[model samples]
Target: MTQPLLPDVRRPANGGPKAAARNRAALIVAAREIYAAQGLDAPLSAIARRAGVGQGVLYRHFPDRDALATAVLEENVRQIEQAAAAEDMSFADILGVLTWHLKESAAFLGLLHMRGSVDHSEALAHALALSDRVERALRERLPDGHRLGAANDLMLAVAMVSGAAGGPEREARERRAMAAWRLLGVEVGTVRPFDA
Candidate 1:
């Protein structure tokens, strides 16, 4: 018995169609690995392999690499909604959670670097509505100072930390991200271990 050498294109039998978000999310995560290891040179077949799905499933979910990359990114930002999970809190708590999310998104940033495309403009635009919601969430938690700047800084910082130019190396990116976290009033790592 031999497995098909060719990319499997069929989806697993599902009597009930899974939610699009979930299916796409699995594909997106798998694609991220493919893109990261291959640095956008990864083929759809490669992604299918990494995803443990069929080529047909890959194609059905994402028509091409660009679409897959787009989906990968969309999932990245979508992951940030957890920042608002700590509803009804002080500004400090709100900032703390958002900052922690910045680190959480670090892996996604690596994926973005691997994708190496500037197609996130549309995604960013779409996130604006959510951005407003996020800002409002932060505002609700803050007091007189009410630094809405944290919202802006957080978005940019996460993007920067995840971006290629954000840091020369992983350690540097972490340090920079933590610094940005502090600036945004988002609590993060207490001290650089290097000091030890």
Candidate 2:
């Protein structure tokens, strides 16, 4: 009896191009959670596990830690851009979003320090654009006589919020960010003059 040989059937790899977008989204979400919980140096394997994907899928989406961090930051910037685009959202509102992200994601602060790296250039550009947009909104909202040094003051306010985000406790971080915003004459939920 001659037995016919059956053709070998192989399953497609986990992260085929069809799945690349989905896999990448999953990886980014996982990275956000893992990084927020364990900081930027958290194991890549942990991210893969959290994403329910394999290491190969993670590598395919993010070539390295910096690449993943950049993606995470880009996502953050995208969020800020959305807030900036809202007609009713004030500069203070956008700053609140930025501070919330910084407080929740340790990687955001870590990657902000890596602005010198080429991998983060896109995120940096987007951030700078958002900064310009927010600055414009701030300028528009400022008292007519207080427009002087608006740009410098906005940058200082951002720096203060970022610096305050390094604290270990969430409540403390929020308090510090609020104080910094107040020092810059911007309130968390409202924008007001320094003396007002």
Candidate 3:
């Protein structure tokens, strides 16, 4: 007899709606880890294996890589929104959260640059809206002479960090991000540490 694709221990016998939800959640967590360690181009099969689900289950949940990527980005946005909601989180703190996400997730920078795609647009919109709020807060905190040159300067700063975070080496990436922060006139000491 042929062996089942998923071990009996991994999948409940009923395999009902709850199982589907569990499989989807597992796939997202697995993809996030795999992508962070191996970049966005990591094979879908690896994600399936890591999630302990069959490839068909993965395809059912995410028809394509962009779909999966959008889901991951949405989760990241949710975390950022949560962090932003903290009463004491300063504008610099928000930037730190954004920078941390970009540095930690290989898929993040690539997906953020995919501006025209409808699949990822909603998550991107939420992230940009969060950035807008941060920019407003920053404006309030800065003196007239230190104000940003344009409405999108915060976005530019984020792009710089995202670009720097994609460097070949981790230490180099951190150094480059710091340099970009300094060039943008953001005080590195004011921003929260990127670890975690």
C-alpha lDDT of all candidate models, in order:
0.53, 0.68, 0.68
lDDT of 2 at 58: 94
Output the number of the TM-score-best candidate.
2
Compose the digit string of candidate 1's lDDT tens values, residues 1-196. Answer: 9976988699857734664555666787777656555555577887787777778988888887767766655554443344434454444554444443333333345443333344667655444544545455555545554443554553454455444324334456456666665655654433211110
- Give residue 35's error in model 3 in angstroms: 2.0
lDDT of 2 by residue, 1-196 (tens): 9999879988866655768898898999899878877888999999999999999989988899988987887776666666666676765576677777776667666644443446646657765554455456445554455523444665555655677767666667667777766676665653211110
Better of 1 and 3 by TM-score: 3
TM-score (C-alpha, index-matched) for candidate 2: 0.69
Tens digits of per-residue lDDT for model 3 on 70-186?
677766666566555666665567566666667666776765554444664566776555445544544554445443546666556666667777854545656677777777777
State TM-scores per candidate: 0.53, 0.69, 0.66
Clashing pairs in 2: none
Give stretches of model 2 more than 4 Å off. Answer: 1-18, 111-149, 169-171, 190-196
In model 1, the runs with Cα more than 4 Å from the true position are: 1-16, 19-23, 36-41, 85-172, 182-186, 189-196
Between candidates 1 and 3, the lDDT winner: 3
TM-score, candidate number 3 = 0.66
